[model samples]
Target chain A: MRRNSPLVPYLFVLPLICLLAFVFGLSLIRLVEFSFKQVRGIDGPWIGLRNYELVLGQPLFWESVIHNLKLFLTIPVMVMVALVLALLLYERLPGWRIHRTILFLPYILAIPIIAVVMKEMFQFSGPVNAVLTALSLDFMVLDWIGSADVALWTVMGLIVWRETALGVILFLSRLMALDESLIEAARLDGASWRQRAWHVLIPQMRGVIEFFVVISAITMLSAVFAYVYVIGGGRGGPGTATMVIELYIFNALIRTSLPGIAAAVSVLLFAVSLLLIWALFRVRRREEA
Target chain B: MTTTARRSPTGAGMMDRRRLLQAGAGLGALTLTGGLAGRALAQTPTLDMWWWGEQELPGLQAYLDKAIAAFTEAQVTPMLQDTAVVISQFQTAAAAGEPPDLQYLWNGIYHMESVWLGYLAHLDGLMDDGLLAASNHGPLSRFDGHVWRMGWYPLPMPWYYNKDLFDKAGLNADAPPATWDELLAACEALKTAGVEPFGGGVQDGYWAEWYITHGLSQNLDSVGDAVNLFIGDLDFREPRYHQHWVKLQELRDAGFLNKDMASLGLYPGIDLCVNGQLGICSSIGTRLPADAKTTNGRIGCMVLPVFGQGALAGRPVVDMQGMGIAAGSEAKEAAASFLNFLNQPAQLASFWEATGWIPAASGFDDSVITDASVKDLWTRWGKGDPITNITNLMPGQFYEQAAIPTGQNIITAGMSGEEAGELAARVAQEWRDFNPDLVEKYQQWASELSAG
Candidate 1:
């Protein structure tokens, strides 16, 4: 047990290493296997690549790819908006704690419950429409999610509303840990507020922001299920306007029950998630440099 | 430096004590489990059951307790443990190769698919047993040419209306709506009386029920009930669905439903009706709780009003619901016995009272039907009974292809009613494309079983 012996620390972390290798590594292997092979019923009559060909050739898969791109765009906007909000809250103004607490409240709400609440508030006969009706603005009371034209945007709005709070909470804690002296020093040098934010604060918060952007993007992609299921009513309908990649994967599971096709969709989704993470990481690296 | 060195020894001692305590807890847990195994091995046989139920779940427990005790006295020592988890649990169990002995499966194309996938055991032997013959009876038990699963209740879909609201509106109580025109008139009248004419459960997939009961029933002869849905014979581009859509839009425009109905769910919408704020809605023909009855002492239930069918329109279309034993169960004997017991006439009657289900079994006492005020509401339904839902006649995959997507589209206005019908026909085509061989196999199996 020499002081510099690497084996001591390696032995201490052996259980966690085994856990990651078996769980994540084996899951990746199975996903790849299912993507390549033919999925039979309880019994096998394997016909390789046929299921993949069937899925990849469909127009809907491409449609879903476009939908996923829209979802991917939300991550940067969400992070930026949340960072701005957190910076304001961190200014230590009157009732700053109350303001921060209020903004962070929605993060504590379960996704399904939030989805339900949002649906009620936005539905045709709900308070939103009631307000429109009372003010004689009935045209504005058009189907928020029911029309093909605005369905995707409506869903994006809901996701942004539901998820921006998570970003706020993350950045708030990160901002609190940030040194105030840096901002003070920049201000003493006659730097404008924008200069201080861009040069001083953002530069220091680079790693934390990158971490947040990647995790939030991943969550945004996978967590579309709640909106798709509750608001879209499980079909991602209104002419498949709200049909995102996760929904397409769900359709393959429920509508077709073809695990091969479903797994293929999962593989596509997995690739997209990795690409998004890589892109954000590259951006953060460049910023840091 | 001397004080810090002294404190390190105390900190190390505290850490050691905590580790020892954790080890002691682990040892105690292991000892308790080892001790309990011997006692558990010697105890009475315990079988677990799972199903979704309403407030009547307590009544079911009481009934089961009595029946199981009688069985125990007759030398069957099995005890039952029950739970109510959602349907997703069944799918998970199917994937994992372990499931409860009995489960109440929503019988549809999904059940048929599960059967084909060999997720269900063939229950022919259970049906053939003398005990089952003596005890169990119901329409759902006999399907195609075989006994698939046993059921005790008849949860037929019916239209419910508030009688007090109708009386206040000065509508004739003796002549309830039998056609679309009359139903509209009644709604119009109720609206004038400052009542919401219809309690729309729009958020709870209420629009699905409306299409199935009213729209499909009006076009039943043209579509041939649920069967034509499978075969793609119904044309929404035809005037049938267009007319219904227009009627729904008219209702919405005229404020026949509550202001926020599209946002309201089933339970909340039903609560509104129960609280006397709304007048009418379509629901199952089961009894409502005491608080849910209208001012006339009962909520009125009727067959869906006729639209295009003319004089034969007032007849009720019976919607059926039943249970299926999951494809995988280790305790097949135990589950089958429970099913048989539930189907017994006395037991079935008790279940009917608890659940407000109509008798699926024949030869129940007339008092069961006659004594209830809600029964009076179902007079037309009882006499001119037409049974089936639009999706029922279709192949079991009708749920996936037609029912789910078409309903969602129509309500959302993603597609017009006519376009939805056309899309449904196309979906039916896909079902044929996918399951051609399986369909042939099922048909052949059915024919062979019928001949035998």
Candidate 2:
């Protein structure tokens, strides 16, 4: 009970540790248990691995996994755009504060809100196509969100637009903290803006860039549900063209009443996310070193 | 002149301690007299009702609020559920042994899964036989000689055609196309008149479901035939089973579908017909009042034109939303009593007045409807020999994976009707593989529905 005792500190934090265990620990155990059973109405007879087998056998599950993989393409685009925008803003360009707010507006707004707006804009007869037709570019007008071939790409565009904002904020913070003397020395050496960026700014921003890329990878994998849900008509539709692993799990649990299948998929997604988290830790450790 | 009235206890914030003491003493005296009422008001059976409808059918909450105040059978506390959680929330709570006494029920497999899980009480003994029958609780609500739901409001599935567009195309608006070929001809004429024809929004995927609701039944001999497809006794690959999608493909191939149909939602798609931008779109009865007014009685409702050789073809389709007692409820009798009370004549009329939509009870008086268009719709789709919506019988797996995506793919992505059938069959097989436990229940349900 003494203030200086290590046991006292452990006691002080024990409640929080126990709370975390109860909140997350207990549910995680049940989730893994459910994954091994045929769950109905919160409990069911255990039929080990049947749910996982069924999930793996279904082509729809594979389709969803492929779609999630497709979404990974957004990270590189997000990184490049965010880095360029951050460098421009870092130069203290005219009205950089206003420009920063404008760039970050998509991130500030909720995903569903921006997604709804994007859905409206990208509809076949929506304003975007109307404008395209109004211009001399009639052939460029395509069914943006309606066609199965184009819907996922449209979703990718939305992901990049919104998620790059976080990268911009992160890279700009890192850029501002960089040694200005190094950039000034590059300028005195007659390096161009692109050269200075590639040689001076980006090399120093490796840690923040890696962190942003890792975080965005996680978002693309598990956090794009709202975008796909809103744009793909709440069922990952226009023929499941936008079906992602998150939506696949959602359909299994809520729509199809197959909680066991949902749990199995959730476990897989959790495992994949854990790997990404490990990679993130390695990056963090190296950065600290 | 009225200073005493201003000083009355009923006036806002005007009560003094003396008046408070007097009011308390009055309440105490009332309680003493209330002993003759057989039970203290506090001891009255409390029923918890979790419901959902106001999101789809506005003013439903107001109607239920008024009815709850009017009923004397029990103390009812109604909670309006979110649309997405109506089933899962009830099932989860029921599994945890704390379900609401009464729960809202969507038709067919939506509630049947809960029934199979033993989460809902059968209404056969709890509800009056005559009243329950008159409630039109549909074949899907019954299984193993027990009924599990009491019908609340009916959604008469109708296809709306723009009369103005029809007349503009030199076709008789009074006589809508009654066969598949006639429908194609009508669409051709409408297109010639520069009007989009024969499709609605499928962007939200509900349009696709409604399409199946009307179209699939065109080839079904009974509601059970639809269930048989999911149970694996029947197959969507059979030409007759998927003829409906072929008809949709025919429309698409002929350019009868609106250019933007793939990007619109069910309601906005219906708005195309109502606003005269398109020729025909699938719709529900609840929208007729506003739509009829918007079009000044120029909107026409009809069954989808027939194509397949089946007993159920050319009949109107109506889907009902209902209520059921939770199996875990402690106050089952009170909940049953409240349900019976809702089916009474006055409550049915109040339902009509509050929602301006027809109650599902056969006892509902149709004369209260004044709009000629609405009356026509009710007379044809509601009062005529109507088939229950077969789309309601689809297992949730089939519905989410096959039913919705098939129509969407055919319309938006150039998927052939045969391809749709293949996809549907595959999804049905997948559903069976995923839910082996529910398959036998569906088989038994199919047999009962077929027998009825």
Candidate 3:
């Protein structure tokens, strides 16, 4: 058993490569194929680019893309809050370990569980409104998940609340692994705590920050289905107000039985996500340079 | 002597032979056990049936279990999925050529969609034995000159009002409103009495469609006219359809609806009606018993008030929930047998008694439904010209992209009726344009219906 043998390493990775190629690669290929053709029950005559044209022509599809972009707005807020919290914890605050565990608790909980709890709390007559009414802020007691004007923001708030935990854990690990000498040198140079954090710690943690932002943007684009589905009550309403691209794809596939259009939208979504990630990396490279 | 025996070559060979025989016997026993298990599985016929919303019906499971048990040749395995996703799952399975033996086909879009896609087997041959009544093979169950599916039950949407609330508002409980003006007066009176006139939620978008369809169906001349409107042959921008929304807006403006109507779902809205917070709630027949129970017999149902002179004046919107044999099913005979057994009068009677759903098969003794409200429902269903829900007749996309959203806009977004009607017309036109093949197919079907 020569450890450095090229054949041996290739053999070791063969199973995983085969599995990925079979499961994901083939499915993607099939999806693209289906996108080009009209799909009825199981199969239909080929109708090139018609599905894509129809999908792109839909007002609802653009509405969903806008909704996804609105959701993406929460990523910066999430990163900022998580970074502050992680930096504070890096100072060894009282009960730091317990605080860190508590902060990460929501990330470990099941999404549906969190979604259900949040949905109940945000109902028009639920505890959140009740509390507002009690506090003499009755005017502020708006329909959190019901009103078209506010529902997307309410969903964004929920995402920020649940997703901040992952951000905190990511930033915390990076902060802990930072060179202490940099911070110490800044402090010895008579820099205040804020100055040290702003100049020394943040600049060092740029890579993790970029990673978190890209990951969050991708999640916002693709993985917010359950949240929107549950909170929007599956129709992505109060009249398509909370509809995201993923839910649109789901509706096209399941509800409308338009698999061709769904596949077309899925391909578009993949393209958008890739473009976003690529843009993020390009920005990071420029900043580094 | 033991030591000498151990060293003997003949003894050693004999022991070796015995060990080999024992190992062979063990292997043979294992193989025999596995073979028997596999054979047992192969011999027992398994029929996969997909259904949804059975949990809401109290006795459906037991009835199905008994029916399945009675079929000695085949065992039915029911897959209960969320109603929202059942059609999608069926389509996926059918496309893969692995569909269940039987699938629940909701009368309007589900049945028509599956039939159009050639995913359902024509069930006309199954009815040749007269297991299902000839009367049951009418429009709801038959399409394209074939009975594509057998009906399970037929439920019609009607306005169920809390009699107690009506009485409290000083309105006649016995004589529910018969005209739009009268209904508005009742709403005003109920509002003045500190009671909400209607309990329905538009948040789910279905309540809006249900309300609009209920209104429009009454304004249509006939079921055919309604179907024509749904298929884009009749313009939705017509004043008749537009007026339905205008009247709905009037209801909203006058504060006759539940305060949180836009935020509540169907069950919650019905709960408000049942708990006596509102005077009226519109729902299908299946929810009536529960309404009656909650109101302690204070609940009564009526056809929606007529807004104008239309063809379907006294008709209620009746829709069917039925089962169809999958086109790809290998056990078609078994599936048809189960459907026939379920359609028998005795079974229908049992189902009606337990669930209060009107049996699809005709000639079932009506005496089984002894509840007064249920009896009233049955009578109404019989007397009314049976028009299908407009939501059911339209393309599924129309309901999602146009009807629901337009209704919501009218109710919540202050969208004018004219605007809503125009939007709806656009959606219908787009659907027809986008799916030219389906539109052509529906036109052919409609022509055949007229010829028949």
DockQ of each: 0.16, 0.80, 0.48
Tell me what TM-score chain A of model 3 achieves.
0.94
Taking the tens digit of each residue's C-alpha lDDT, what string does model 1 give over B39-140? 675453444565554442335556555666655312233223232223435555665687666655543443455555556665668543554443233332
Which candidate tops TM-score?
2
TM-score of chain A of each: 0.87, 0.96, 0.94
CA-lDDT, candidates in order = 0.61, 0.91, 0.80
Per-residue accuracy of model 2 over B129-171 as CA lDDT, tens digit each: 8888999988889888999999999999999999999999999
Please provide, for model 2 over A101-200, each residue's C-alpha lDDT reduced to its tens digit, 9 standing for 90 to 100: 9999889999999999999999888999999989978998988888999999999999999999999999999999999999999999999999999998
Q: How does chain B score by TM in each prediction?
A: 0.71, 0.92, 0.87
Error of 3 at B259 (Å): 1.8
Interface RMSD of each: 4.7, 0.7, 1.7
Q: Given candidate 1, what's the lDDT at residue B140?
A: 25
Give the lDDT of residue B441 in candidate 3: 71
In order of TM-score, best first, we have 2, 3, 1
Candidate with maximal lDDT: 2
- Candidate number of the best DockQ: 2
CAPRI accuracy category, model 3: acceptable
TM-score of each: 0.78, 0.94, 0.91
